[model samples]
Target: MSINSVKGAAIVTGAAQGIGKAIAIRLAKDGYDMALNDVPGKEDLLHTLADEIISQGRKSTIIIADVTNEKSVVEMIKRTVSELGILRVMVANAGIALTIGTEFLDTRLEDFEKVLKVNLMGVFLCYREAARQMVQQGTWGRASSVNGKRESHRDEHLIFFKEKKNNHYRAAAEMKKYGITVNAYAPGYIDTPMARQALSVNENLSNEEIRQQIIQRGSSSSGLAVNLGTPEDIANFVSYLASEESKFMTGQAVSVNGGVFFG
Candidate 1:
């Protein structure tokens, strides 16, 4: 197959780093062209990722847009279909952890709203725009959201996560007739830049300390995997979900959290 040859095209939000970056790269390797999305100021990272994907024999484009904005999301989908081919996958992975360590009473209203705005509303917009494009194109596609599940220890952001999961169910139902499947990937403590940032908040922890903290958290559960999961762990599952193998899966949030929260 030529470098431009592709199974389809996928748009992964928050593709600049962490799980989103992993998913984008994996999808590209899976033979799908990639449209990488991230907020402004992450152009360097996105550009570098796009180049890497192109180097791997797949077409790639960088789309800088804020998922929280409806117009931006629409434009992103439009540009993606315009640049790449039909949209086969939409990974709504852009999110923030502003209230990660804050208690419910200590969390400010602005912080809570910011979290919802990015994590909840962002996923909703991506799902809406992507579903619209898929329905119009009459293509079988997959849409998945990250951080859509709440962990027991992360109860402060319960509403945000719950809302994201709800969006998945609703989107899956509405898009089912159009041959589009919407799902959510609930990751436990994946080793990612975001996780490190969240863990290091107001703490004097080194990189190794953070890694050990994540390992301890995952080990607390009697899961099959006792170590912290890498971003590729979630991305590999996403690859399966985005493929024809998961045609029967929809309206569900699968847990990739190392058995931390079993379904």
Candidate 2:
């Protein structure tokens, strides 16, 4: 849907900064009320955003949550809805990752599990809870709504890259019955705080030398103008997907990485 068409409150997780913050603020400017979420110390960052939301005269509630924690996620959604009224959009944007140096055989088993838990499993739990709430809201939202699907219809075919695919897709399938579309946007080369940290720490190259590598990659691909994309560039595309305009689309893993990982 067009920006003007997206109304009501949206819950943007990991929103104290980066693409999450960009999405939250962009929605506020579009007249959608907001429910923000971040880790504990990021309260101050959200406070600044809450002020910006209020300055635009939209409603807001800031919540601290860890998406990987099921208990924390459930409580976060419950409080956000109770305080903000309804949840139209759930971003599932919170993720934890690292560019660990350990080789495959040398890596601790915990490293792989931790990454899978937070990045993959966390998104599953958030979608499960948010879809339940958002689906109920979606019914109240429009006309000719269908009832929840039969249990057998919940199956969704998904690609398996590393034995983690079906797990997340199963959660997404549950989300479909509620008219709440769920999808993941796999970002590539958009400069966030996390990527910059990894880039700066490269022992094999100077910071400027590493920066040039990133620039050359993006600029050489798909007509990238500046050679590096800002978080807002990713946020803009995500904003469209989260809106009602993308009703016919769901369960996609879109890559915004210039020309990376093409089939």
Candidate 3:
């Protein structure tokens, strides 16, 4: 599609790899020019993804910024509008999962803060900046986040995931007046590098063992599907949420976890 014929621009944070990369590609295929964002070191990956999007006949730009800093996020939004077009979709997918298997008592204060800073505070900044731009443009927009649901067992990192989910609801409620919708996708046991890293906390476990653990965890609840979901699964759902089809949905943390957790 030509630039004039494409859907409005979108900013997908954490677009260097895994779910973020998948979302960017899917959005490009769905015909939105993309602004891909990640931290400093992932320039190569972001550039490659941008090239792929451009090859698909859509405009793409790489914006490297730390989401935790307010100024950085502001610049990210500014650059997206300047480089791509009006900000119509913001996928606040950039996040970190640290100290995953560590006990709450053993977790350091700084470690806990780091998790919240990236997972919680980062999403807040992305949503806030994107909403500001959308409202200013006087146009309808979509902002979707990738989050995790609360589990029966406590993982320190899950706290921030829950908070991220809450942030989506609060942002959705507040941004509705401006014709902007905010929502989240809660994925369970997706086979992403991040998921592998979280499960690899035990060095003794083999890759197959870790795979089995993910499958088992995803199927723990009776009558649920047994296989782990792919990044494309979440991306497909996000495609709907980012489009006009999901106009009535907002403030919902929709579960894309193969029935592992009902929303």
Candidate 4:
């Protein structure tokens, strides 16, 4: 069935690039009018993505806002509801790694603070605002977050991973009465620009070497076939979790990391 036959609206932060971009596109294909957001100054990219969604016969709006800024995020949520109808799904996909590849002792305090602000605080604001709208609408809704698999050197990564897990339960508990499901998708070794950039920082390996290493490591780690994932893999999972078919599930962190680690 064509995804465009589905219904509702969704807001995806950091929708200009990487997994966020993929998710936004997938949702549009899934028949969700989209409010695509990215950090300020990414207007050109957002415009391009908006055009793509419009081409798909879904209403698309470019919402340039800083997820870390309270005022901006508030405006983003409000503008989305005002322009795109009631919010049906919230994809909190905007995040950053400020202290990657740095030693604990060498990591700057400012960098750590910035990471927390964007990765943790940003998700919190989006969830809060989206939940408010969902509760007011009195319609069932879904709030899904994009999370990562464990990366030892990435302190920011660990923080967001924990947030994704813990907040799933917390949000589910609080929002159950409102008929909104809170869940997360944990992706491992997806071939996105962010993943490539993170791997590329290892100066010891060439680009092809980095790619091979990622594939090998993910393959060896997971019980499934030794294949890494694409951004669409995660997007597919998000589409299901956002759909009415997943109504019975909540407070769950579904891992799409090729079975890398099992709980």
Any idea what lDDT model 4 has? Answer: 0.79
Q: List the residue pairs that clash in candidate 3.
A: none
- Please, what's the RMSD in Å of model 3? 3.0
Off by over 4 Å in 1: 1-4, 150-153, 201-208, 214-226
By lDDT, the better pick of 3 and 4 is 3
Residue-pair clashes, model 4: 0
| Span of ten consecutive residues with least summed lDDT in model 1 | 218-227
Model 3 Cα lDDT, one tens digit per residue, 1-263: 44457888999999999999999999999989999999999999999999999988999999999999999999999998998888899999987765345565677889778878887888999999999999999999999987766654433534555666667778989998888898888877677777777666465655566657755554244445445678999999999999978888898887787766576
Ranking by TM-score: 1, 3, 4, 2
lDDT pick, better of 2 and 3? 3
Cα-based lDDT at residue 11, candidate 2: 80
| Candidate 4 per-residue lDDT over residues 1-263, each given as its tens digit | 56456477899998988889999999898889999999877899899999999999899988888888888988998999898888999999987764234557777789777877877788888998899988999999999886554544444534555765676689889998888999888776576666666555465555466557665544333444434578888898998988988888998777787665665
> Which tens-of-lDDT digit does each residue in 1-263 have in candidate 2?
44444376678788887777887888787667788998899999999999998777788899898878999999988988898777777776775544523334554667657766666666667767777777766642211100111111111112213334454455556566666566666565555665555444455554455557655544233344333456777777777776667777765666665554353
lDDT of 1 by residue, 86-135 (tens): 89999998988853455666878887788778888888889888888888
Per-prediction TM-score: 0.90, 0.77, 0.89, 0.86
Q: Model 1 — TM-score against the truth?
A: 0.90
Model 2 segments more than 4 A misplaced: 1-6, 100-102, 138-164, 200-210, 213-227
Question: What lDDT score belongs to each candidate, Candidate 1 first?
Answer: 0.81, 0.63, 0.83, 0.79
